[model samples]
Target: MTLLEQLGIKHPFLLAPMAGVSTPELAAEVSNQGGLGSLGLGASTASSAREQILKTQELTDQPFQVNFFCHQPAVLDAQIAQQWIDYLSPQFQKYGATPPEQLNCIYPSFLDNDDFLNVVLETQPKAVSFHFGIPHAHQIQALKAAGILTLVSATNLAEALAIEAAGIDVIIAQGIEAGGHRGIFNETFDSSVRTADLVQLIKKHCQLPIVAAGGIMTGQQAKVLLNLGADALQLGTAFVQCKSSNANIAYRKALFDQPITQITASISGRPARGLINHWHMQIDTPERPQVPAYPYTYDLGKQLHAAAVQHNDHGFGAFWAGSNVAQIRELEAADLINQLVLEMNFA
Candidate 1:
């Protein structure tokens, strides 16, 4: 069956769930329009996840996906975290502020959050997806028992094989051009295999459905991936400029203006693609200090942003986007989906 048939959605596209950018309203509108919408719960607490899920349910009876980060929890290091704070003190001073006295881990990893699992089980969204890594076998079984269709992102064939072996329902074949955190298992990136290549690679070895993601901004691009063996497409940057997204003015402006783009780990201590802003420029140098893992480094980065925003500067914010963000349009979510459908049909 087609993915849309399985999900009972009208379109063959899925909104790439962005943890901070996605909203229940956006997800609802997309799902209501016959494409699957997703709520990213990677950074959310169990309580917030419940609230968001309930809210999305309120907005649409159509199926929507919920996404989580299944990565290992950040290992807190007081010395290194302090060093990070010290390293960014100057930038903090630029906005007349000081970094938090101590960095704190903001979000709990799903691997460690039983409450989140319970929330998922109780809420029972039609689809559940993971990034960074897959959940445990028992967790997977539980989710399946609850009738949730499972998906996980795989950047390379090895990761794709792992996902298939783990009995996942669908594989999100994420390419190097995909924005935000990559779904690589080891967090070490080898950008040689891009989206289309990865999609073909995964299709050759695994029978699981493949959802192609990367710099897919237009319908023609989506058609190419579909022709290359992708069962569906997941678009992140293309939806950021939508009215339902949470992208701020600075991020929207940066997308519209086409700032220098690069992949940097300074913002979140993970290789995420975004506009090259002051934050990236300052920390992407070879001489930059080693950042603490995953979310530990993310803490201070947010603090720096809070300070910068006080002075009307948002270059410190995490304005993540794919390589094709330069072509984003400022349309509503439903309209963008309709246009993409038209483009794909013509292509």
Candidate 2:
């Protein structure tokens, strides 16, 4: 069966499962329009993730995918955590707030435990995709036994080969231009390949279906990747402007006003591309210290953002967007999917 047939969708479009921004309404809208919809469950607890999955099931019977983070669990180094906190404490004080005494691991990795795996089996979405790394052997075995397709993000040929070797159903070729997290399994290294090039590179060596992601804002761009052998296209920044998304007013405004984006590891202890803001201009400096581990550093970043928001400083927010955010349009999910289909055909 073709990728579209496996996904149970008419159009070869998939909504990038943006964690904070994806909503049930948006997912349903896209799926209703014959495009595969998605929910980013990496940030949610198992219970909350199940709730969102059930809610989306009620909203539409059409097929959609749920995503989870698969980063290796890291032990927090207190000294390093304290140093990162110390560096950002001045900014906290500027807002008349003190930073947290200690940072907590706000998000859990799928590899950390079977909590997420159990949730996926229970909720049983059409498919499940992972980022940062691939799932464990037992996790993959259970998912396949349940008859759910598994997908994983691949940033380079090595990661693609690893995913193929592990028996993942599809490979999401996440380019360096991808807006959110870099999805490089090893945080220490990233090949930083672009979308079109990565698609062809992986297609040449890997047998899995390739889903092109990153910096795809228009159907013309989507067509380019498809022509280069991408089995499907997944876009995040384009659908962020939809009404059903959870992006705040400030984030939505910034998407248009400041289309320029930069990648920084300071916010989440992982390199993710987003609109240029304080994180890029002020925090990520030449003299900055090495950040703490993945979710540990994210804890402090959230607190500082909350404190800044009380003072109307939205610049501290995690306003993630792809490199092609400048081409974003303000359209509802259904309308945007329809427009992409139209443009894809004409292109």
Candidate 3:
């Protein structure tokens, strides 16, 4: 079967697996509308992930994909975590909450996370995907053995080649314009290639089916990529305001009302694009310590964010978004998919 046929999607539109935003309701709605919906399993626990998959199944019999972060094992340095906590003490004080003495990493270990894998093997979802890095060879083989198609996020030609070589079924060519985290595996994210350029380069070097992502908000942008030979389009920010999404009111409003700016390794120690906020501004200070890698840094940030939210402070949260955030509209997921299809058809 062709990529679209194998995934049981009528249109070439796939919902991007957005951490903290895309919910099972949203995924099911898109899948029910004949588009491929995605569940982001990066931040969720095994039980939560299983529940989410079952919920999506209950909502829609149509096919959908589940995504996880195939992250490297976090090396936690107690001293380094303490330094980060100290750095944010002032902010904690401002919120009338004391920062924890020692920070705790709340993220699950992907290397040891068999929960999602076990869920996949048992439930046998139509498809699965990964960001940060590709899964181990045995894991990939096992998923294939279960007839589950796999997808991988690639930020450059080299990464795209690697995913193709790893025998993944499809490549999500994430451009620099993508929201949330950059998915470059080897090279530092500072060297991220733009989406248009990366798509062309990957198309030149690999024969795998490609799904173009990054800053894709409008039907016109989708058309531009389709014209460039992309087999499909994966979108994130476009669906942020979808009624089925789990984005908080503050987050949705921020995306629609504010102008997005590039913040380098402020919230997370990697180049990420999002709405500029008070926490991001703090990272610009010369006195701030270096941010820890991924889940560790992400965990500390979450603690501070929870404290801030308790006091109704929205500025400290990780309100991740893409460059085309302005185009987001408050509509139901099914309605949004209908609009996108109409736009794509008209274009």
Candidate 4:
């Protein structure tokens, strides 16, 4: 069967499940319009994730997917955490605040426990996708038995091979240009493959369907990946501007006014691509110490951002977007999907 057929969607489009930015309305709108809608529940509690899943189901009967972070549970080092806190203390001081002494693990990985797995099985979304790494074997088996499609983001061939070996039904080829967290299974290394190249590489070796993600802001770009052997296209930055998306005023404005993007591990500890701002220009200096770790460094980053916001400095916000954010348009979710279909057909 075709990838779209397996996905139970009419179009070969999937909204990139963007944590913090995804909304039930946005997910439903995409699914209602014939593409796969998605929820980024990596940051949500199982109860909250359930609520979001049920709300999306109420809004649309069409198939949709929900996603969670599959990162290995973060291991915080005291010395490193203290250094990171001390380094950012000055920035906090500028806003008349102080960094917290203990950095909390703000997000729980799907692999850390069975909470997220239970949510997926209970809600039974058409698909469940993961990032940073793959779910445990038992989690994968349970998901497969539940009849929900499984997808995982793979940055390079090794990760792709692992995902395939783990019995994931589909692969999300997250190019280096992707916004948000890079889905490198190993935190310390990234092969840095681009979207088109990654698609070709995976298709040549892996038998599973490929979903091209990252830096895809236009239908022509989506078509290019499709030609390169991607079975479907996933767009995150392209949908962040939708009215239903949870993006704030500052984030929306920056997407249009400042389109340049760069990857930094400063914001969330794990490296993610977002529009260049203070984190890129001021904080990520040559003398910057090694960041503590995922989620822990994110704790400090969030605190500093909160303080900066109080002082009316929105540059500290996490305004994530793909490298091709310059090509972003001002369309709503359904309209954007329609426009993309037209563009893809013509392209």
| Top lDDT model | 2
Candidate 1: segments with Cα more than 4 A from true spot: 189-192
Candidates 2 and 3 compared: the better one by TM-score is: 2
Alpha carbon lDDT of each predicted model: 0.88, 0.95, 0.82, 0.94
Residue pairs in collision within model 2: none
Q: What C-alpha lDDT does candidate 3 achieve relative to the native structure?
A: 0.82
lDDT of 4 by residue, 1-347 (tens): 99899899999999999999999999999999999999999999999999999999999999999999988887788998999888888999899997899899999999988998998999899999999999999999999999999999999999999999999999999999999999999999999999889999999999999999988987888899999999999999999999999999999999999999999999888889999999999999999988988988887888888899988899888899999999999999999999999999999
Candidate 2 or 4, higher lDDT? 2
Write model 1 residue lDDT over 1-347, tens digit each, in one string: 87778777888889999999999999999999889999999999899999999999999999999999988866677787777778888888888897788877787777895788899999889999999999988899999898899999998998889999998999999998888888877755555468989999999999999999999999999999999999999998988888788989888888989645688888987788888898667867777887777787888889889988988988898999898887888889999999999999999
Better of 3 and 4 by TM-score: 4
Candidate 2 lDDT score relative to the true structure? 0.95
Per-residue alpha-carbon lDDT of candidate 2 for residues 101-215, written as tens digits (9 for 90 to 100): 9989999889998999999999899999999999999999999999999999999999999999999999999999999899999998999999999999999998999999998
Clash count for each candidate, listed in order shown: 1, 0, 0, 0
RMSD of each: 1.3, 0.7, 1.6, 0.6
Q: What is the lDDT, from 0 to 100, of the residue 164 in candidate 4?
A: 97
Local error of candidate 4 at residue 280 (angstroms) = 0.2
Pick by TM-score: 1 or 3, better one: 1
Instruction: Give per-residue lDDT, candidate 3, residue 299.
Output: 68
TM-score of each: 0.97, 0.99, 0.95, 0.99
**lDDT tens digits, residue span 1-347, model 3:** 67799889998889999878878899998999988999988888888888899999999999999998887776777777778878888888888988877655666645565777888888778999998889988889899999999999998787788899999999999988888888867524555777888788888889988899998877778888888878889988888787778989998888878857565565765567788888667666777777767667776677788889999988887788887787777777778778877888788
Against the hidden true structure, what lDDT does model 1 obtain? 0.88
Residue 158 local lDDT, model 3? 73
